[model samples]
Target: MDSQTMRDLVMYWQGVTLDDEAASRLAALSTSVGKTLNAVAGGSMFDTEPAHYDRALIAMAERSDD
Candidate 1:
């Protein structure tokens, strides 16, 4: 996200105003989180914990009336 956009989002959503240093820190944290999420997403979905998603979906489908 753009720095300005992130700052705007922080203000809009969190009702907080960030100075330059805080904005830079927030940007770094946001970048780290994005990279971490990307790395996690690169792994196989089946290996995720509690990986009974397919079974849960099947159960949900069976329970659906239509």
Candidate 2:
């Protein structure tokens, strides 16, 4: 997309106007997702313990009726 179209889409997703600082921060975060994926591919320090991950699917299912 052209810069103007991309800016419009970003503003829409942000649900408000994008000032310079906020726009830059969001763009930085967008770039970080790819960096995180690359780090995960190399193996993550945060993934050492399986028990640290909470699989709350059963709780979510029970709460769905409420």
Candidate 3:
């Protein structure tokens, strides 16, 4: 995603303003996450099933409740 899209996402989803520093960090994090995900999934994000994504999110929520 582009910087503008990331900024909009942060503002809309998290209800927070994105300063230059925060935006830089978010961009870096987004790149790193995309790289890691691509590496793990053989460069295709669609390789994973949608159900797997939902299950992973549910598991994360359960773990956070601990």
lDDT of each: 0.82, 0.64, 0.80
TM-score of every prediction relative to native = 0.55, 0.41, 0.54
Better of 2 and 3 by lDDT: 3
lDDT of 2 by residue, 1-66 (tens): 334444677778865777666666667776788788888778655755554234655544555557
Clashing pairs in 1: none
Model 1 worst lDDT window (10 residues) = 57-66
Which segments of model 3 are wrong by more than 4 Å?
Answer: 43-66
Candidate number of the best lDDT: 1
lDDT score for candidate 3 against the true structure? 0.80
Clashes of each: 0, 0, 0
**Candidate 1 local lDDT, 1-66, one digit each (tens):** 556777888999999998877777888889999899889799667756776888878877864567
Off by over 4 Å in 1: 43-66
Which parts of model 2 are misplaced by more than 4 Å?
1-7, 41-66
User: 28, model 2: CA deviation in Å?
Assistant: 1.2
What is the TM-score of candidate 2?
Answer: 0.41
